[model samples]
Target chain A: MTETPSTGQPPEFPRPTAGPPEPTRPAAGPPETPRPTAGPSQPTRPTAGPPEPSGRSSARPSQPSPRSSGASPAPDSQSSPGPSGRSSARPSLFTPAPGAAPVGRMLLAQTLFEIRLLLRNGEQLLLTAAIPVVLLWLLTAAPVFDTGDYERVDFLVPGILALCVMSTAFTSLAIATAYERRYGALKRLAASPLPRWTLLLAKALTVLVVEALQVVLVGGLGLALGWRPSGSPLAVIVLLVAGTLAFAGLGLLMAGTLRAEATLAAANLVYLLLLVLGGVVIPLSGFPSGVRTVLELTPTGALADGLRSVLADGAGLPWGSVAVLAVWAVAGLAAAARWFRWD
Target chain B: MPPCDTRGMSTAPAVEITSLVKRYDAVTAVDGLSLRVAAGTLTAVLGPNGAGKTTTVEICEGFRRPDAGSVRVLGLDPWRDGAGLRPRVGVMLQEGAGFYPGARPVELLSHLARLHADPLDVPMLVARLGLESVARGRTPLRRLSGGERQRIAFAAALVGRPELVFLDEPTAGLDPQARRATWQLLDELRAAGVTVVLTTHLIDEAERLADQVVIIDAGRVLAEGTPQELTSGVSDDVIRFGGPPRLDVASLRAALPDGSSVKEVAPGSYEVAAVVDPRLLATLTSWCAANDILAEGLQVGHRSLEDVYLELIGAAAERTAP
Candidate 1:
């Protein structure tokens, strides 16, 4: 509403005319259609390995007139090459014929598109980026909880990183996907050439991309605040990846199975509950032994605990935490695949 | 032109549905419907609301499973070979059902184009569909007007240049210009050797665009052919006039052609149904003249496609009425 209705290309756009509702017969109709000069070539940006085999359908002997206007749909040189793409010669993308793009390119495009959308949304950015960074600064700036041996920076960094992962992979993804399903976006996508499962794959990839950026920002702040420790870089990646898979699997499960409003409420509630009780901002050791035992088993608690062990404790790898994440990852993914409905 | 019948088509049809039957628990939506959409031709599934048009098309799009029947799209089973066929087929679901609410038209469409190997140029499509004005706006698709959203859906349906596209009411809420533009785009799709299967209740749309028109009622084909064949196929043309009701009907019937039937279809409305010609029309007027009846409004015409459709469905409804 804020933007004025600027006529960017009035000449190019076919404005509504005050004409009769009579359908223009295809055989003979007004020939005033000014063919808009098709601007330029859409470069086939090969995002992945190579161009696909897109040669099943013979390139339409290019429409002669494509018949212009009214009854004739104007066909230009840039029309799609229908039917053949995807399983054919993938290396010859230089003069890409019209057809189905490689599955890899499609997945990559969708992933990037999704990532841009996620980053652009003020709410998603708040949950995934702002909240975690703000939480990191707050806990590090003033020691809210007493830690006997560790500095606040040392204890809060790993835990807040876990918080960032959960916020993105579970809450943000679940809410967005639930809405997309509600709006029939997923159902529409199911009709496209991209397999439905690849959409879920793209979400997982988007989470990892966002999580990497979170690491740089939050981890840099922790370092600036005089935090120093060490853990195997590979171990950190493994933990984060496993945590992502587990959370993403559960996120899609909730999104695909629950109604949009239900997913929205449930995802936010679970995130808040875990943020308080899963040892992200609070220490599990301070609680009763019985409570701590149950907390350690939760995926959120397991991820945080494992991250803390690796970074703050300088451990090689937390196999127990990995085991818990693995179990959740497998079960959640299996269930999502089994019960997810596109409509 | 008289549309070629299925028996005349030498090549394999693009979409062939055989004895499709779909049931929703106890209510059968599609009951033994069989149809053949010839390759590279536009076919309109014309029907009233709740005539199982959506159900039949949805099953063809692989969204719903038919309880009984087989569907082949481009020589592949729609459900089992969905992955293989999806790349070659485009679908625009009813009421703009398949679009994400918050996504912009350009971004979503570009993403879809990438999924296909050779897609129509995105910017070109936008301009072609007359969506340039709203294309760059920050508003999500959900906030745009229904016509704009419909244009985007139309763009999505054609982006991949699929061999066969299913459009479920592609022009429901469009203005005349937009509707005409949509019809043009469909024509262009057909020109490119793509098969188009669209469902609409608009009589003129089917009459103007479809090479094959299938009149469906109660989930079955009542009559189907080119608009010419369908309208001209009925044996008798109706001669109708507004006159005083219930006046000497036997005398009128006896005076007209031997096979002609006359009746007062409504109060003060009479129709002489027969093989109408100038003489027959003249004879009916003379008969009215002789009876001292002033035919208020006299008209002669063959049944239009709409007339055939309404009458066929009315008959079907009576037979199936509870």
Candidate 2:
């Protein structure tokens, strides 16, 4: 490739400004010749010539004589509009036109990348997917969870599913985002042209994708152990979506406000607390009568109970649980938006 | 390229700040500072640490909001028009500002490239920055050497083909070779008529690359001029030599030209400040010979940007010291 020649020059003292007597353009002009072929067709084409460089560095000795002849053809092509075959016909070099892909494509790319990162992190995978499946199997076999009225698998499956959604959406996302903020990853993205909402949506989408995998894995294992889900399809879908939105919103709220280590400790602590008292592992029915109402109002309790009613009892849409989740989702998201700090 | 009118007008300076003041709780980071960067020129903001250089640049990049001042980048307020301005501007933050520790160089660069209107060719940029070997590998960004990480950050900043690019300490930890490569790239950017502003603590970097240098200290601008203009402001030439301590300055001054001044700044080192010409040099040597004193390691040169920088910051520090 013609570009390779430019790359071969010694990078040291490459500019003429370093008290070197040699003409700077002799070093710069040859490499710049290949830029048009490399750049997208635009107004930048006209300025890709020797005169352009001289104009900017007028303080430097203008010595375009020796190398200008050798480099003339490159700018010649750039100056003559649309004459070169590649000039007018090529697609945009950088951004898609408005109403083209824009945010959708960027969001999709960010989501895919986020998923890749989540999958690559062994700890994230274990927490979001593996731990839930392992718990589902272990809990169903335990005699302590035997409630006498229903099969143990019937109760444990939906609870673990709710736990999985919370893990992926809240614990894992909060920790990751907090660390990203500490590392300036979020700040860097903020400086870019990507819309802020697209980044948030991409994170939500990543959580959803991971949660889907968790459902398939844990649900498949439940099926193997003779657990039957009797919920209406629409209710299960609504519960899963609402659960994810609520937990992820809470996760971001914490991550965006707290320091990374604090977020890490707090997220794991909340995860464990909800897994026990929020009815994911221990049913809310067993709790004392007074706090049971309050516990049911908590996001985790609402999600687990909602999932249980739909998936185990074959119930219609649990509007009470749905309403609770909607409140948490709206409140958590609003808080996060108000207080989020990229740095 | 000519500065594109992404905001429907192209005549504004690439960056303009008027009476910018930024305070962090009890400390003022930037105080009543104003600067204007002309379009299609390379300007370097030179300052010591804690001089508010980074804070000023961040405001221009729309990353920070100044407490009380106006900042216009390419005819648009950077904060109000960030969405519109970001596409046309590129920023390389200091301290490896926002890279994922686990991301490979190519993955991170391409992800950033998709965010702009007309990004440069990614592979070509990678090659240009001499990141081919690292880009081909899967080593995470945190695992790469400091210089390598810096190069990737630099590439990310330039990949957008922006009309105005802001670089913060672009060559802080780079080796000599890598530093030179970065200078070459800045030159090319200027040739393309892209307005470039860089903040650095290195005086030589500002001297070599900047068309205009603004020396800032203690949250305010100390001086602003071309390197030559700043260096020439103090004296036309500084003559140095190693000689006897406690020289007779009275006799030397009497023998030398009317404007020439001599001082023994160190134990055995002497410096003479004057508009040095052949006659001045002859008079000094003749005076030294007649005094039976030997001048060794004699050298004549103009004041460097570093000398002026130190003097400016030193004076500022003394004034601010309680």
Candidate 3:
């Protein structure tokens, strides 16, 4: 029996493109079979309508105008016919059909899906939510550490928030993207009808979504435990957004230039290093004077210091820290744009 | 005519590569290669590992920049206009290429749907790829079988109804059934007038699917022709004279005429690579009759694609061998 409807498109067959050599895209004509699009808000279903026929051998009787421009199926004796029994010509699925207009909306949709996938993963959920809680419990319960004049919760909460942003944007995002490049998902997407920016933006958006979830979970947990932010909630929101964007940029920068293994190693190594150097677990004042100066300018350090100041001392937003974080974000984003590889 | 006007279509070929050279450190991945993929045709690139098939495909996909050489996909430079060109080109990479764990087929396809103006139906795509059984499943992508994940990936690739597609060995690890299904899907795609460029080492896949085959070895083009054309020129009719007796190449060659040549094909047989006209067959039979040489298990047929591929690969290996 034939594989697809008897269309006049060229024969498209399977060829493994990236890794593991499992043939993914079959060379078939564009089977624009008018499927049903999923709902828009659920983040799980497709935006297009659902397709007709679930079985492999449904016979489509309508004979549209056959466009016989490309390579038709060869007259090979071994080539099987389509299910329709009409000349046994199966439509090639790999053939490119025309798409109308630009690819922005498509990109946005992809970004949201990335977010949904990240959210649903158990490991990701633990990293985003449980990790911050565990760190808070560990840091606060330890008797050896001194809290200076402020409450231990006040000093630690802001730092943990900053840490949450960094984990989601940089460490987690790096691993995910690196693996994607390794697996050929990125390469395949590069070949699809999606725009490049859409891919990047989708990734960024996914990070943002997870960050939003982290904020709600961590922030709510902090507030319930009698910890109060000294600064305006609005200012804290700004810090969270900026910090997320900065870390996301850096994450992508690492994912784009390095091999998946390298990205994973470097991302985790840099993340842990920043945690210690940037005063997430320990205050920067405890470090030597020379090292303190260097650490103060890092995005992670600046973010932690600025967040602690606002959340503990009721201080206004720190323009210096904001500028440093913004610069890092822009620089990392530019680098990713220039060098990212999908496969 | 203008730089791109021919028969109301672009005069410049849909894809144009000029002395494409790509290198990694000291290794020359692709060396001064050039090719043309006319719009609306299926072109297959055939090569073994490290033969620069991927490097060439990536250059066309706009994911990697070449060390040297210019590439144009759909009259637009891939490197300079990656975002602009991506919407028109569809790519299906090798299996396990990349997957977001915890993603279902619908979720992934819908996400890609937002990237295009005219995307196919998600359920329809799921059904077409035989992903309906798992459509409602919540398992992460890492849990899906290789074949199932590939189907999801395929759905994602076709979501936008792309104008051009790049398939890098699209069916390497599939079972016979999945491979057949994939082939059918590809046939459906070609009927819609999509231009496809695929790479594979499986000679049979290329032979069955490709209208034109571009054979590559050592980062260069070895030959380019229709599969039939490439196989038809093999001068020798491969004769596998199998019995209880073993033969050597020198003895077999000596047994034939002065112009005839023979080479060992397997342990018990030799292939006579010479023109086998009816007169020669008669003369051979007459000679065998005189010598009491029984030509049992004698078979004659045109060379298959595997023969051509093996010959090309063998020659390349010999040239590269120390």
Candidate 3: where is the Cα deviation over 4 Å?
Answer: A1-96, A100-104, A134-144, A265-278, A281-298, A323-342, B1-13, B67-70, B131-137, B145-155, B233-238, B244-259, B274-297, B315-322
TM-score of each: 0.80, 0.81, 0.75
Pairs that collide, model 2: A94-B118, A94-B119, A95-B117, B1-B192
What are the DockQ scores of the candidates, in order? Answer: 0.16, 0.12, 0.19
Question: What's the candidate order when arranged by decreasing TM-score?
Answer: 2, 1, 3
Docking class of 3: incorrect
Query: For candidate 2, lDDT tens digit of each residue in B1-322?
Result: 2222342323668788899999999999999998988877779999999999999999998988899989999899988988888777877889656887678899888888776645667887786667899899989887899888888998888787777888999999999987877876675566556678999998877877777899998788889987767866466466777888887776676655567788887988988887554334545554555455678877655566788899889898898796
Residues A257-283 of candidate 2 have per-residue lDDT tens digits of 999999999999999988888888787
Question: For model 1, what is the alpha-carbon lDDT of residue A265?
Answer: 96
Error of 2 at A327 (Å): 2.9
Lowest summed lDDT across 10 adjacent residues in model 3 chain A is found at A32-41
Q: Lowest lDDT 10-mer window, candidate 1 chain B?
A: B1-10
Residue A165's lDDT in candidate 1: 87
**Model 1 CA lDDT for position B288:** 50
Higher-scoring candidate on TM-score, 1 or 2: 2
Docking class for candidate 1:
incorrect
lDDT against the true structure, each candidate: 0.76, 0.76, 0.67
DockQ of 3: 0.19
